[model samples]
Target: MHIMRVIVILFPLLLASSFTDACLAAEVLTLAKDGNAKAVIVLPGGATSAARETGGILADHLKQICGGEFRVIVESDLKDASVKDQRIVTKSTEPVETFILLGEGGLTKLLGATSADLGPGGILIRTFPNAIVLLGPGKTAPSDPYGTRYAVMTFMEDSLGCRFLWPGELGKVVPQRKTIKVAPINFNYTPRIRQRRIRMAMGLGERKSHGVKRLGFTDADYHYFNKAAMVTTSRDGGWANWHRLGGSLRLASGHSFGYMWEKHKDEHPEWFAVQPDGTRDQSRSPDRSRLCVSNLELIEEIARDRIESLNKSDLNSVSIGPNDGGQTSFCRCDECRKLDPPNSRKLAGGGPALTDRYIYFWNEIAKRVTEVHPDAWLTADAYSVYSAPPVLRKLHPNIAIRFVGLTYTNEEKRRQDREDWDAWSKAVKKIYFRPNVLLAGRRQGTPVIYVHKLAEDFRYLASHSLVGTDFDSCCHNWATQGLNYYVCAKLHWNPDLDVDALIDDYCQSGFGSGADAVKSYFLRLEDITNTIAEQQLKITQPFPPAVIDELRGYLDMAAAATADEPDASKRVAFLRSGLEYTDAYVAAFRIFREHEAAGGGRLLKETKQRIREALDNNWLVSRGIFENHHLAVNVATVAWGSWNYFGRYYWSDPSPEIRAKVESR
Candidate 1:
């Protein structure tokens, strides 16, 4: 896997290690030479949208690299092929002398490589004497095939040193060359993880923000998420390339039984949780409610609901939840408690874990659902108190669990989460991660660096039961935590990729002449987080005043190094803005904490106002260089956001008094 992305240039030896002249001699296709088009791109007959889109992207990139007119045409447009023998590509419909054929069809079948030979999400990029085969199984890619699209992106990055780091023009990195070339290549790759989902802020998935504006999030929160929606839906196709690196596997990961509560509260009240005082617990919101997992009738109803949903629609999986509120709020009914282990232990978040009962619940649903539709999948949100591994039994094969909350901040909690994941891996037939690790820096990020930890998890999980991952949100704070998402996308597709090399590529391509300094700045930031991870800190607790100065020095060095380059300089300044926010946050948080102790209303108001101003300034600074809407709602506005008032806040417009108290002074 490490050698899979080998760059076959002179410097290719650095990435691939194994080098021989045999590679050079095997080079069958000469794409361009002396700034002139040497070959035309020919798509296989009856190409799908995947083939056409990838072909167009390849053609566009080749033209940019060599300043040549690389015409893209379908195989049906080719001249009559009585000469299928030696050079079928020699007489393309276009005047080009050679052709770079797309996809695995007549050309590739003649060469002995085809899509039938590969696995799901598998890619085959073979260079023949007259054409290059780029073929893969085009399934579940938001209407595009990630396999073939990934093949094209792989070529652009490894072969041409072009990178799609972030959205917009500034994040794009393409090396200019007078000529473009390819060596003899036979590469076959399928990502280690099956469903590689990296969702950006306000993406199509999980459309709700957990008690945000709909429940009382501020005007800022509303504006931020509403605007963040632009990237995923952008007409310019900026976010499309990033989507190529991800899978569109619809493993449902939300509160699932809200409709059940709404429909059955009056008729089947026993299906719901029972409070300590014996009244059946219920809520208008599914997240605010709890379920009595021991209710056999309730389990049957859910299974029946899933089977009906499956019979009607082609949805990938249906989610089953223990819902939002934690353990103490869980059903204390005798039947449910009977499933608990004799010596139930408390987890870091407080739990005589309900994981066993939830697992029992999903396991029961799996049994019932699979009886009706054998292939129908059930997704269990193994979250909250039930987030840990079940004590009783392994999950049924038809059930896939999505483990949320990889606590990256507190060392103890993170370790427990990983251990729980390891345990859950053994107990479940299928598992994927959905960690909210990015919330470490709180909302207005400190550019928290957890690259190594993320690398470690992905590498380890790929070998385990990891089917895929759903990183909570790709916080569009590119200037701050973009590396997290960048490295995340690369590793999701291929877990064995060199983390250091990916970071080097990111720093060098985006930061230009200041690559080394920029790299150091990020590594240093990572180390800062690492050093303080054991402290069990919250929000600004990890960042120190002295460290901010040290980070500023690294940015200053990068600024000096990239002074002659506008794009690189602006990026450095963009990072500086994040650092300034971090600096301001630390100070503001300290003041708020001090005010908390002294009961100083003046100091608290001053700190909240300061945070609001800093957020506004950060958004202004990101205008030309970055996406402005992703300045988080919860973590960023912690001192004033609706998170603190989760149960009370509503999505309606705030009253003058409520807005002043929570959002303003």
Candidate 2:
């Protein structure tokens, strides 16, 4: 009676069409009741690859949840279907039969939505009297029409209580039920960030670690997965279901045009930076070869090159920003220096102010490029000495500036970066949060869970014209920092999402009954990450033995509780292996300290043993999106330095055993 009363109140006009039928209106649209199909999944005529794939995803999941073959068909072919039940009910409530529409079609306008209403990456889900309409843009690549796919997923997630915790099939948590029903539903959503990608260098065929030693890697690297598991992890980890996990707009990142030095050095000698000594050579300077942005000829040439590239294929945006370096060089020509402002802010300590010149250069290029491609965007970074806003000029409408930021662990730096982000929002047509702050390369193989700070920062940026985000890198150490990556993605789609609820969902889905133990474990990691008062304190602080033991205790409990659930058990095992690797690194750091103080072969021996254990543990994690070996190969062996525990002895041999083991492959 309450359902009928609410239905009548909500749709007075629809009630007028069928007063008698309204009395017998179906209270719930049943897709599956008592493990039998009641509705058919329908697609519009001439469905694309995206449409078929999305429909299949919906059908597969429904079958998993409620049992019974859910058929997918184009609207035209619906009449020729050979299912058990083909009785189509238009307005009657008795002997119920319904169709689930998946995308824009002829009846979509009447159902109250169209492509125009839901723009790029927008979604609409509505339950009509006879059908449920899932509407979104028809995009085929990089998660377009993903809006439609997301609509189906959203309905299942929000209404039916499902959770996609991590990558691969093991990561899915589907609740089983014999009877699944839906009440009147109307929902709409669009991602806050245009692109929500967390790029992992180790996955997606970046390296090869076939069972034994392979080209450029040891068997320990685990960078490339085994062929059998690779299909699942790579497809999931490498952008196969990127949209379902909230990844959208894939755009190019900025970089300094450093190659111009080699390409134009002999032919166009004047295009390179001029040193203070009036030499235009890159050979002698520490910050070799910054571009001479003031040169009209150079601007014309760069514009011409970009235009030619655009002519070859389609590009959403073009990136031409400065190269990354601690003390990068810039053009010191008279024309360039004249454009520098008096109160130029320094990104590092008392750095050069190249903001005005670079801004002028970007605007000029934008003007020339847009003459032919008006919608094309020019991307650059608000970084280094030129990080401050331009005082001399305004940016063109086609320019998008990605702020180099998010050092939330450093209070002062975080404040400054946030202020600059806000300031740049006013100056540029678009702004994105592109931070190398994950520091995966620098802090290699440690749990750096800045998730709460990330949520806070992302929420702030989403409201301030922040259009997209691309973290510099991910090591795929999912067991330790999985929450950071997962939460970052969830917020990318829904800027105002509840972080606590998201964490609960993840723990519940991945850990099952052991969720409490797993939740305690990750929360402890988050606490440890946020409490580090100084990010740059170079103090060789011991990675507290007590804390390690405490976390291990939680994992042990999780392992016990999840023993019955095979899927949860696997995830717990993955996390435990990661912790072992972290503990090994910690033990090695302590032993190295003792060796430095007392100078003994025994301490060095202990350090090598710990490192060996680290490698052993790394292999287990590598099987599930962990890039521990890739990090060791990149940061530890060749780039070892006194600053890090792993790279303590590079000049001669820090740890003869570890270095030898790492380099031998």
Give the root-mean-square deviation of each candidate in angstroms: 5.6, 6.8
Name the lDDT of candidate 2. 0.64
Candidate 2 segments whose C-alpha is farther than 4 A from its true place = 1-26, 80-96, 106-116, 139-145, 200-227, 230-253, 256-258, 275-289, 307-317, 325-328, 332-335, 367-376, 439-443, 533-542, 594-665
The residue-by-residue lDDT of candidate 2 on 1-665, one tens digit each, is: 43344334323334344233432453457888898877788888888887887787777777778886788878776444322222233432324366788998655655555656565577776666667788777653344446787677666666565556544455566678887787766556566566766665543232222322222234444434323223332122233244354454545556847567778888998987776678677754334457778999999998887777667756667776766662335777889988887767654556556788789888888799889778888888888777877877888898888888768456677777788888889998778877876653234456766777788888899888887777766544455676776777667677676677677767876798899999999888767765553554322242568888999999999999988988889778777766766665455455556666786554355566665554433333332233422322222211122223344432222335644665676
* C-alpha RMSD of candidate 1: 5.6
Question: Model 1: per-residue lDDT, tens digit, 1-665?
Answer: 21244352212323342333544466446778888888877777888876787787877778777787778888767666323533454443446655676776676667675767566677677665566667776643343355776677766666666776666555666566767777666667666676777666553222334324333444565556555534421122345354355655566667776566678888898988887778775763544567788999988888888888888876867777656754336788888988888666576655588877777888898898888888777888767778767766677888888889576567777787788888888876778888888656544456678899988887887888887777777756666777887888877777776788778878877899999999999999787777667775665665667878899999999999999998789778767767775675465455455657787554345555554454333333323122243332223333223224322212123344544554443
Instruction: Give all candidates' CA lDDT scores.
Output: 0.67, 0.64
Model 2 lDDT at residue 289: 57
TM-score of 2: 0.79
Top candidate when judged by TM-score against the true structure:
1
